[model samples]
Target: MVGARTLAHLAATAFLTVAGVVATPTTTHADESSDPDAVSAALWLATEVDDNGGIPGMVGTPDWGLTIDALIALEATGADAETAQEITAALKSHVRDYNSYDAWGVPGQRIAGATAKLLYAAVITDSDAEAFGSYDLRQETLDLVAGPELGLEEGRVKDKVDAPSVDSSNTFGQSLAVLGLSRSGGVPQSIVDFLIDQQCSVGGFRLYPYAFGGGTVTGDCDEQGADAVLDPDSTSMAVQALYAAAEHDSAGALEAADKGAAWLASIQREDGSFGGSGPTEASNTNSTGLAGQALRAAGETAAADRAAAWVLDHQLTSANAAAASAELGAIAYNGESLAAAQTDGIALFQRDQWRRATPQALLALADVSLGEIGLVDVDPGPVDPQPTPSTPGPGAGGPNGQLPATGAPVLPLAALGIGAAGAGLILLRLSRKESTS
Candidate 1:
């Protein structure tokens, strides 16, 4: 309805600093050697992360959620290991803040997507997902799952708010939940079934889970009227999650995952790029990077490689960026963004676009798929039991001193379905190493 989505009401952040006051790392383009484009990208991300391990959003707010996305991207490429692990450790103190903001409706509201993502992060980071932060993320996810009593579709990971509210477990949340659980202890068939229910006959998945007609989340994607729009980002996430679920013997996961990947392939532009619905209608790196990962996960190697090529075209390589410019290796939001950067450089205000774009696009460049990702050496279990949390708790202090009202939509930067990924790649390697150990 409105413009794209919000991180600080909108996305991106500039190089090294925002206005000279913002502190960033000193690592430059020369830090990492191999995979120059991706290494430089990781270096740039490391600079953006503060000692506290937070990445500021549009308004210079501590973007706890986006920080996780950055860490996932960094780990996926196996670059900046120190910074990634340090930030992962730092986030333990801010778990309440991140969970509340990205997951929404904390204290009372137990949202599946929110909780699932936190579980996803904990699992990927190799933390005891069963005992992270103030809540047991794994248990929270299982508890919020919609049951036969809720009158909603069974096995669906729904948002459990205080009052009886509509299940807000969108396609993205459900997919992430499945991925998180797939590692924690295998996903349930009903969970897989609920995910399948969201896929349209055409193979694409919708964002809102159901196409509402009379204010209720009723009817299938095809049954809905003009409002029934398919989201590439959601479909991408679903495809990857389904691929993972398939390993656990979910009946329809493999079929649905393949169809979802096929639908994404069918919609790609001639340039091998994908775009999101609504404000992100143009082929952009965020959507394309996500789609590329899904394509590769589905074994659509050629399509994924093509998608990566399109994504590379948008990155600010050493050739395009000034030698001293901190923005080198950063990817643009789209062709228009690349042109703008080439014409006038990445403006200070436009940095958010670069920050948000780089991580996901870099993942595509890395050519890593989600279904195969396993854990790394993030170490498991909780950090030294956080301080006896204050009134609203740690991170509730926010960038200033306020939290988004309970039930805020998870529409901001990295917290969105698009930004939160990297499970498959890390899991692929770590889970295997874990087996041998």
Candidate 2:
């Protein structure tokens, strides 16, 4: 009997031939040993990690945030258990650095997003969030929540340390806080409420509640009018958090998620790709992957599949194989990046962009949302089901609570295909149409 994987490979080959994907043929072949694209992408991220135990920032500094993202990607894909544990230990040692503006500080400037994200990592790993290393990440996250003195923004999550910092309190961070607290300690309704308030009357979420330079926490999405910029990335992140919140029965979270999904659907490009805000206004893998996951979470199957197809196009696989073996399975920043990588291996300066893009872009290929983190296994095994209705206790699930992986492993065509395109490129043109929502 032809194995299931082989059968899927044959079907995928047939689909590629019928669709007539355009690409330049190349002698380079995809690394077939790499089964799922998620694992391949996560392993590629592992290759980029340095002795400091994290991905590099501008000027070769260890970027704690990107390191956390890589860790999350690894855990989500169930790639390497030992590496995930190593990242956890490293981050735990740098808990103060990860959550604070300065390693040495008087008042101890804590970053709300960082704290929440760390807490989330602990929750997924079944580590003690209440006491991670010397810090109690769960309590610390709660401390970052705005108080009643802030009036309408009382429940909002804020850095409260230095406003000008990168990856500070924004819709993205707020979503992290919600997700971090969702399954373990449980999120407060008010914090969830604040996230809900971020939604515009037009159905999307903004990056920040305040103006770009202004840090007063003023500015309502509704009042922005012509200036109302709805970000696909931020909206998608918020939707991921809201889906988890909805899973927990947080009031109005599901509705807000539904509306956000609708806005994403409205903005999706003709080819099923998505764009980011401000500088990243063109079709890109990051936005498309994030939006695709949100759409899948919202039950938009066709939209999500379209996104997965677009991301596969940018991936360095057997289909669009790079000359170097190291570059395979590393997703590019965009189509241009993919094309450039085909001719010139990803440049040294360009590696950082590719590093950031791969993990997020892997989401579309994974077909799982960060909101549902730990719920599905990347390489799952048989497990006994839960007996009670209450949430799984710490370590009950592998990360969030390990359930058996659903569906078959994806065969990202950067491997082998049924038909021929060009010598050095393999662009996918799936006949799967945009389904009526």
Candidate 3:
């Protein structure tokens, strides 16, 4: 007769115990003098950006979404003004009519998630969201939510512009829409309600409401089916949105955020990592970063610290520099994929995965919470005339600027022994791995 939440927490504890993960101190006390991981990761991201200021994708093309993620990381880590200026200028050049596309020449309707991410970045960087590169990012994001074709009946944000028939947008997009809209000005009550309704009874969130079989009814969340897989990534993002909205006096926002944070804490592996319920079922940096930030935003400091420690332990630091070579500071998606990429010379699939993982991991290392990033008040002003070195002061790391090792034990994913879910969950494939918020 155990409740679902209790069952989940018990399962997590059992998984951790079986995996031999020894819990570390959840309290983090590092300062600028002691922590260089954040700065090093920021510098690594700066190097990844091309001359044009966009982060290179798997195919070596400019990806605005990835660039935005990197920018957020840079801001979180307090990167040099010149570095921020160069990247923001580059991001500004790519602004389109209504939204910023993921990459140029990709021919598809504007992605609501991408637009929402850009708006959030703009606000944090103090750029004019209402007038960035001749486009009003704030207005455009609002339009995407208000448009009859893109917005669902009860204020849900649709995934794509062309797919008018599909009413329910993915939870990632919905969470971003809520965060962006709330930060830009004020989020509508209906929009907030729609996102809240997406939470499942188990306290987790499904990536999408509609069943994946393609014959399900439009805009439904009451019934659970094959498509209703509880995803850690979506749940984390939803927690972030609810926390941000709660700051604006939104009713039930804080309560919902607490529920989502509890779910994340309950599901965390002994190694302090998280995995999605779909394609990304293995513990990886991307899910950990998202969940960590959400936990911090919700004031779940113990869970947040554990998640951050896991990310730091897995990063390519001086301890692992010999193994990583030139890839130092780049956070791998997972140890298995990193090994494969090292043996196979960075395949196309691994390119975007690393690109997305590094910045997210950096955010955790920097101890930057989602609520803090959204509330950045720095005005986007002229770039600093002089650029400073990426290296931190003495007591920080060594010449290569590697982070000081925390001596935390590295745990493998296999130890958990929580094999993938049934085919019904795996076959849905609705949740594809992508760059994060």
lDDT of each: 0.59, 0.62, 0.57
**lDDT of candidate 3 over 198-312, digit per residue (tens):** 7776788776656554524345455654466687877887887777666555567777778988889999888777766544676777778878877776667788788777777
Error of 3 at 262 (Å): 0.5
- Poorest lDDT segment (10 consecutive residues) of candidate 1: 428-437
Taking all chains together, the TM-score of candidate 3 against the true structure is 0.73
RMSD (Cα, Å) of model 2: 17.5
- Of the candidates shown, which would achieve the greatest lDDT relative to the real structure? 2
Residue pairs clashing in model 3 are none
- Candidate 2 per-residue lDDT, tens place, 113-206, comes to 6677777778667688877878788788888888778886777777544323332366766787787777665777888888877789878997
Model 2 lDDT at residue 282? 68
Q: How far off is residue 427 in model 3, in Å?
A: 15
Between candidates 1 and 3, name the one with more favorable TM-score: 1
Model 1 lDDT per residue over 295-409, tens place: 8766677888887777777766555544324466676666666766767887767676567677767666654555444332212123211111111101111111011111112
Off by over 4 Å in 1: 1-36, 101-106, 162-167, 212-215, 375-437
Q: Residue 276 in model 2: shift from native, Å?
A: 0.7
Against the hidden reference, what TM-scores do the models get? 0.74, 0.76, 0.73
TM-score of 2: 0.76
